[model samples]
Target: MSADYPSMTTAEIRSKFLNFFEERGLKLYPSSSLVPDDPSLLLANAGMNQFKEYYQGKKTMKEIGAISCQKCVRTNDIDCIGEDGRHLSFFEMLGDFSFGGVSKQQACTWAFELITKEFKLPLDRLYFTVFTEDDETHDVWRSLGVAEDHISRLGEDDNFWAAGPTGPCGPCSEIYFDMGEEVGCGSPDCKPGCDCDRFLEFWNLVFTQYDRQEDGSMPELPHRNLDTGMGLERMAAIMQHKTANYDGDLMQHLIKLGEEISGKTYDADDYSGASRSLRIIADHSRAVDFMISDGILPGNEGREYVLRRLLRRAVFHGRLLGIEGAFLTKFIDEVNAQMGEAYPELLKNVALVKGIVASEEERFSTTLDNGRVYLDEALDALADGAVLSGDVAFKLHDTFGFPIDLTVEIAGAAGHDVDMDGFTACMEDQKARARANAKGDAWGSFNDVWVELSDKVAATEFDGYDNDVIEGAKVVALVCNGESVDSAAAGEDVEVVLDRTPFYAEMGGQQGDAGELSAEGVALTVSDTKNHNGLYAHVAHVAEGTLTVGATVTAALNAERRGFLRRNHTATHLLDAALKQVLGEHVSQAGSLVTPEHLRFDFTHFEALSSEQLKAVEDLVNQQIFASKPVVTRVMGIDEAKAAGAVALFGEKYGDVVRVVSV
Candidate 1:
């Protein structure tokens, strides 16, 4: 049946889906940033992330319906990616959303028309699934001329959709395509919801009509919404008559580039060795490119950490393919060239992407070399078929950034096994220690309190950038001894929130400003400042008088201390540029600390720098300091800052508007 239809590129399928819905009056919207605005999500894993507010009734939508091809990143299946034909860390989701405009019948009808008529998929090969209790959706599919036998009623686990534990919840109907009996598990009951590759579920239509209350009661929403998502790559694979999504036009180009760089041909049947490496490289390359273009960088925490893992995994796979030196940038260039048309942001960020990839590759190459020595020693001590201890695996991962899966693969290839259980225990132990240390810190243990206070008080207005003093600032909230309080007496340590402040909260590796908050019959010494979700909390103690919420205070920053801090902060930036100049562009800042007395800059390097190299870097920094280069600061959009070639530090989150500092 697929033979009658012309094979289409992934881009073509995407266009057809958008155009089909657009012609039907659905407004088209571009993909949102992969870095989601929602704090609960690490990355934009779904097409509905941008419209979540609308669905929750927190925000209203101007358009009744919208269609988009959103770029999504999901790493929950990272271990499964490249091992299967369908799993991908990064993919485009073709979605059409309705806010009380489109109905269940319309959604099913449009989806059926697009798949069968526009995409030319055979109707006989299609199947549908609905929640067991959703009679309305079942009847809609039946009325659309789908055979009763083709529609399967699935349980809540498969057909019910929920935003969370409690929120907008409803039943969903999914469309599946059968790939013939030969490719499926031989079972008489194999159907649409079967756990087999033969039934490929390509699209899901969600009918959100109920608002679930905290008490588990689901009341019908006043306005029903429709949200449907279809995987672009999956549809392209079916249309192109390919078994694997990687074989489609979009990913095959990347795989071909991998073959060229590795000097190896990809074998579709070989899933365990070189071919698997090729597939992983192809997948990770695209994910890494998109993540960087979306303003994410390789770092040690949060989404930055996810990007680092993907990037390093791709590099390791390249090593498995016997590719030496830096080859990821080649793949990055191909990604930009092929996908730039659909996502022009990739084209604009090409230089930045390549530079970051090259830097991580260089650092990983050195780490891999060092880790191999330790891994070899551990392997030599183990007898054939013996297990290597998890402590060793943990050390390799912690000290050298080596991945556990890589360790397992290498050990298995050498006729040995790894103590995965022991490795997991070691990881847990480390986390426990980290949690313990966090509890001991004054700032870390009060996070929940700060979150509660943030809800009650408005965000602090920062007035410290230009002036050292902010007069007549009203205290909005106060916390004493980890508990919210109305007032604090003399010699009591407390956290004070002000409506406006001149004290700079600690951020971006810089120390918080030390200041004094004074009012009539009040003298409080603010030792440090910390920001919790834009609410600045001044950690202070009453020196003489009583201080309470609603008291008008004058916040005065120590000018002499701030002068020294500014000098040291500028020096750290100079040191960063000097290190990169002396140690190649591969040198990237790993971490830093900027205080009034001195500054410490941590960076990625292959090994300890020689005395000569250190002297050279020192001289370069000194030269910059002596040259008296004008230190200019400009406020602009993040895109403009990147376009102007401003270096953004990894692990530092930047908002839409950024302050770019240049020397």
Candidate 2:
């Protein structure tokens, strides 16, 4: 924008929003977090994602009304960045939030006031768009003195906001900053709202008025909210007299830092895609740095996936510049030194965060070479002149971790085009694999009823390791393909139920319990223990006794299986810490399993684990195991646990207190 944001400095924009709301009697809270307690999201995609439980009535208000500047990450548009002027992986949201009650009209009025009165911009430069179906937003905007002509009506796709299938969702009215061009106009003559960046949609006011159902349907919400996010960087670009977002002072500083480290000069030149790579590197490094500092490391799936992609992208650019090693990690300090004051957490754990990035890059560097070699193999596949579809290339990327761009780049180098058809096939197959489940065949009722069973099972104390066999409790329920047997003998299989037992059913990615459920001559070997029709249904692979349905049975978990589980469980913690030490502080565990073969810990870091780094982590974990350190569990307040330097896992909602284990 040629306009110097015509209002305030980046710092002023941040402070003005918070201060205005604070003076209006709203609780001005600092940014809460970038992570979420919800697993459905890859990252804190929205300011409201972390506040979902609050909007869903799962948690009470920390305060009745509050305002915050939140750090948010969105991967939905990952493929669309670099070319766009606005989309970014990491961005700060200047938000005025409310936990309790405040009308949408107030939301509209305050937003209008903040832009007009506080920012001191020309009123004519502002425009508002509301959902045509939302009478409330329309009325509110009108009440706030926005001229009816200045407010455009858009369908739900553009003007309504929903986080997920079932959560707070409602109509949104976006406030736009007019660039005095064709698309910025509210007139009927304006070309649709798609790509003319003439009108930059900056602020959005989402009224959480609906909740979506599991079957992909929407229902009304009781307590609506005012959720808004205006990007600080984008806003700064307009306020700082920059044509492009990357050209802004904030990102330029990071660009300069990235350039210096790579021993490559970044300037406007025809070095093929080198300048683009530099820009991407500069942008993505900041994204990864901020993410790691905020406690997200790179891993395989979800947010970790985003980190992994960013890390690899930056490193790939490094290779293009002839830079080597885990140089991206070293820039963590540069990021901290530059933006740490704005985001202290980045500076606070700078060392740990850097190590995570450094280690991942070192690992991904090799992966990159291998990935390139793998593409060469694909090029070999293309030598016969058979069209290599995107599917085959995608597999090389998926199974072998080949960077997709490298694959395409290599293909282009080989004078061969990729099979766009094959890639789609492979992509669809992966989606199917992700969606398929035993429960899927059971209809929607499977999860609906079974989820209630975990709640129904009396908090059975699982002492399987100490003692697998326990006294019998009454059968809670029965599940059968046919009629119930007399005694469920050793070889005659039958579904033996349990009211309570010491069995630790398969959960947390652990294998199901397999042991004998016995009563006198009726000994049933449980091949699997899973939830069926809201009850723990023990599948006895082999049984002979004709057990009656109501017979009391002793529930036992397999001793060997439990021991294996313990080894795996204990190893998980060891590998987790080792990963942090070898990788970086940013290496928060994403997911892992300790199987009979070996321990696997998925962590958030940009690059893959190098042989040297992975070996170091493996050695460190083994060292702890050999040291015979006691894996001690301590019960204390959740706050105390955090204060005691305990690591918290994602998607776990701890109570006022928590159970923390340390070695």
Candidate 3:
């Protein structure tokens, strides 16, 4: 089926690929259809998208031959499109991957050579952008015999594409097909990444040689790779001599159809609904079909929300295009008959996809009335035109998932401007207010010299399940009020003393337990407990007698809190194991919270916990509880725990003896 690709006209270019790679003895393979499950990414956004697990060292590439038609999504610049000449929301990347049993120089040279020779592109028309500090790619390009003048070096921010805070990130060199002088002069400075479109990015070659880690570090990858993504539609536009991507091959069909539906020829110069609707129709039709083919049914959040929003936006444009009766679904067959071979899911799930799109389309058909009213309200807010309030904006986003763009769209129609700056400020203020309230921001920072505190006397560890009471050790330090006085004052004396008390330290997602210390029958209340530098500081207030250093006393802690903390802490470990058991091996703890009520575990599962997976995890956790598993906590070597497979979250460094808890 892959032999007979959809969009065969583009296959003219595909034939050139097969012959060129075959001449070099690199096996050709069909692209994978699997969607990535990384939670951080909404959808597979690049040709190399599905292979991320392999590139990130999460999974090893097992296939020998791989060539794919990868569907990619990029939403970062959604607001800029429809007005720009070359932007398209959804696109397919024609890709060829080499697993690196071949020569590295050959892979680099061949990619450059094939485009210039086999593709019959002009040599001077080609420009190469390399990472500024990347000696590997630089050497490879020069070794390929490209003229030095044709190569451009760029710093990491522009040339290197990092997914995020961590993962498979490395230097990348992109192949740009110059559009000649007619596209206006190069960006003002005529510099790389100057927001100029004169250079039509044709293909990207990511030599994934290093895997970046969660801690902003890099590890050498076992298999150096050659991954490439050519913009298939863009190629068609360039080869066919068209200025706009939508005006080229496949979309041209969809564009003309939208024209018929709208009863108006789209004017390229305007941002009117007529032009937007055509772009929407041409775009949304392709996306909906691809999503359905990938088994993504519409729901809420994540993929479903994307599908729903895309459908509604298309429908909103249909009001612009003047088409009705679930217009999006009607276009599925054209997509199926057109691109179904390379992506068979299109024809396979047409019924299911059509059903879902139709049902949702009909459901939202009634919202036009509501949308009109919402538009009026937004316009009213724009009347004062100073700034939009956060609560009102959030209300729109929450109540109807009404995006700022849609609000802006309506605002444009009414000849008014949105107070975006005001809206954002008000929104941030409200968020700060909420966070401050929750964290007791109500407490104020006193002016300097108000409360002088003293050095803390470290509290004794409860040693978990042990003798609750212990003979008090010598008080190392003592203080009164804010002053580090030698003795407690006559009134209620406040002190932070280190006596060997069995109170537990607040750590490992567990709260510190509280108790009291008494000497010569004079009781002192342990007001609060905290930890600093591996030491538990017991905040104490004298109830009867004066407090002093070298005072020996009886130390006690709250038994109930200790018991609850133990249960919750133990349960967290069990849930961690349960998650690894249910989810794939990639699952790792992100963060967690533990209290007497329950343990909330955050991990790297992509989608929200499915009802079934959620039930399974909950059941597995409670099953551990039912087993009444003895909670064991120990201080062991950090290496010992790591070798023992203990869960470690990001940004936390461990000392020699780390607290390893197991149920």
Model 3 lDDT per residue over 420-525, tens place: 7766776577558745555211111211111112112333444435667777556666655545556663356464556455777666556676788777847788
Residue-wise C-alpha lDDT for candidate 1, range 1-663, written one tens digit per residue: 344667888888889899999999989988998987666677898888777655644344667699999999998778788887888999999999987888888888989888888988888889999999999989988888899999999999999998666668899999998877877899998998777788998999999989877799999876788999999888888888877788888888999998898899998756778888889998999999999877787878778888998999999999888998889999988888889999997886676678778888998999898998899999999888899999999999988889888899889989988999999999889878855654222112223566567656789999888899989999999988778899999989999999999899998788999989998899999889999767899999899899988899999999999999999988888998998888776566667899999899987554578999999999999998999989898999999999999998855778899999999
Model 1 stretches astray by more than 4 angstroms: 1-3, 380-385, 412-415, 426-663
Against the correct fold, how does model 1 do in TM-score?
0.70
| Model 2: per-residue Cα lDDT over 1-663, one tens digit each | 234336456677787878888888877655656675444444665555555545654344656566778877777676555655566777788877664467887778888888877776566667788888888778877777777777888997888776644546778888877655633445656633546666777788877767777787777665676777887877776666554566667677766776787666656322246556667776787788877766676668656777888888888877877776667765566667667787777876676677677777777877877767767776786555556678768877686666667777668777787876788688778768866622222112222423344444443344454577787666654445544334443445556557666666664445667788767766677887664432556778545455665677787777777788778877787777887787666556666655545656666655557899978987898888889866777789988998889987642345687668788
Arrange candidates, best TM-score first: 1, 2, 3
Best by lDDT: 1
The candidate with the higher TM-score, 1 or 3, is 1
lDDT of each: 0.86, 0.68, 0.65
Q: Backbone clashes per model, in order?
A: 0, 35, 6
